[model samples]
Target: MVPQPFPRHIVDVAPSVGSTIWRYSDSFGLADPEAAEARLGLGEGGTPLMPGMGDLLLKVEFVNPTLSFKDRGAAVVVAHAIEQGAERLVCDSSGNAGTAVAAYSARAGVPCTVYVPAATSNAKTLQAEAHGAYVVRVDGDRAAAADAAEEAVGRGEGFYASHVWESSFLAGTKTFAFEVWEQLGRRAPERLVLPVGNGTLVLGAWLGFEELRLAGLVDEVPPITAVQAVGCAPIVAHATGRHFDPAPTIADGIAIAAPPRVAEIADAVADSAGEFMTVDDVEIADARRRLAEVGWYVEPTGAVAVAAAGQLGDRGGTTVVPLCGAGLKWPGP
Candidate 1:
């Protein structure tokens, strides 16, 4: 027997609820209109855009409800899951996505189970559990946890609220672009520097900008540069024509050995005329220190993009880098 098709993750149109996505609802793919309306309100979006060293403007996403940019996606995904009659929500995350799912699921009154890689920070795992989620630590890598979550979903145990696979989550993340556009005086930036694990943020930003350009709201979409840890830089390797063997990096959030959305990410990079880059752990740690010294305390993962900004060097335009997670999420100096 042929297997049934899963629900379409993203749609062309979403509901207008006066949030960051309302104006662009006609451009996004949303799973449930009711769930979109029922989305949790924990001050997820509207993060501040602050001036950083040089021309790099920092989109401070660490102030989000879950202390990470993942909340932007999780709010929409969990609400959609509940509207679709899901009794339980399941996902695999390095840390931030799991915490986001757990928090949103709790808000929606649904049980949540998050599978996290063994190397996930204790602070993040504890945050997820604090939201009343059942946390399972997978042995191997982030991909291993993703495999387990997929297996559970295939067994009909729960709805897979995957941050990577769920189109709505990407829609939620697209708000970053919209916010940036508005913050930048209704214009698109010249470049966007972001960290890529599953490539959710990069993809979402591309979609959002594409919609805006199509709507004649923006003249152009900014080139979106992605920063990956040197240890696990598949997209970088693919783009640069270099062989990659996964190593260890402090940017655990983007330590994805095999990203499920590599093709899509590569497409976004090409479409935006952007580039992929890699930063070693030492560089990440140094960047983290610099950011902290400047009073912007972000995790090592969030510092990857900031570290990469040095490579751009006097690009004559507004460059934006999203500080994706809080520094306190990890335990270190």
Candidate 2:
């Protein structure tokens, strides 16, 4: 098969420029979705929004195909890569993104290589491998794994499908806001709380809401409350003028010592009248247990949203917190 030429840069193609590729693609605005070669049989979006503890509405993202919100972005990134005729997809992830890319690439019949930190959860790495991805364990931290992936991609070994750097991926994640608005009677919620690692979900939701407002779909965007693990919160530290050295945390998903988009996250939160809150492992564990009692059963990282919601102290309007990953990926309590 002849290789399709890759785009020189990723552009936010207007919705008018493309047909509806998925129910949410109308909101995503990626150009030429029908031309994308990758098509995963597994349904990617439409996670349920249900009632949660203390006036919190839960966006149950853990029910996705790979049991994490990462599937949303991976679906788009993999599709775009296939459209570009990539021989293989490559990415570096702590866990969820790797599993997501693995699953989507498998469905697309594309080869995949995922570089993951050695400390990544065993269950997550196993899941990636189960999806037929070649899992390469890198020594050191998440950033180190990312660097290795970049270097390999730089060598033209495979096309890079970075969750953090890819604009198309955010197009998929942006559906979160659209779904929330639709779920809440086509109205914007009062507030949104979610865990932040590389700030993909938070940033994507911001983009989603911004697009809605621009399109005159919603009058106002909700205040987005971004949650971070106390152990590793560059965004929070920058926002509050606090200093922190990265430490171990149960919320591995948001344990990003130096997020690539920290400034963007801080600026977006500030612009939206939202604030950043940090929760320790104990708080995350407690939140996880509470969610389990309520029958949610999410990973500690997913529980970070709930844990931070408790710290917000009565925002009053309807608040949505995303429960992003499944508890089955970690050891049972």
Highest lDDT, which number? 1
RMSD over all Cα atoms, model 2: 10.5
Pairs of residues at least 3 apart in sequence or in different chains that clash in candidate 1: 11-29
For model 2, residues 172-291, the per-residue Cα lDDT tens digits are 888888889888999999999989989889998998898889989987778988988888988989999988777899888877777888899898888778888888999999999999
lDDT of 1 at 61: 92
Clashing pairs in 2: none
Shift of residue 303 alpha carbon in model 1, Å: 0.4
Mark the 10 consecutive residues where model 2 has the least summed lDDT.
Answer: 13-22
**What C-alpha lDDT, on a 0 to 100 scale, does residue 125 get in candidate 2?**
93
Candidate 2 regions with alpha-carbon error over 4 angstroms: 1-21, 27-31, 35-38
Measured against the true structure, the TM-scores of the candidates, in listed sequence, are 0.91, 0.91
RMSD of each: 11.5, 10.5
Give the alpha carbon lDDT tens digit for every residue of 1-333 in model 1: 999998878677766345444444444455544445555556578788999577789999998888999988887787677767889999999999999999988877789999998888899999999999999999988999999999988988799999989998998899999999999999999999999989989998998898889989998778989889988999888777897777888998998888889999998998999988888988898898889888998889989999999777897989999999998899776
Provide the overall lDDT of each model, using Cα atoms, as 2-decimal numbers: 0.86, 0.86
Poorest stretch of ten by lDDT in candidate 1: 19-28
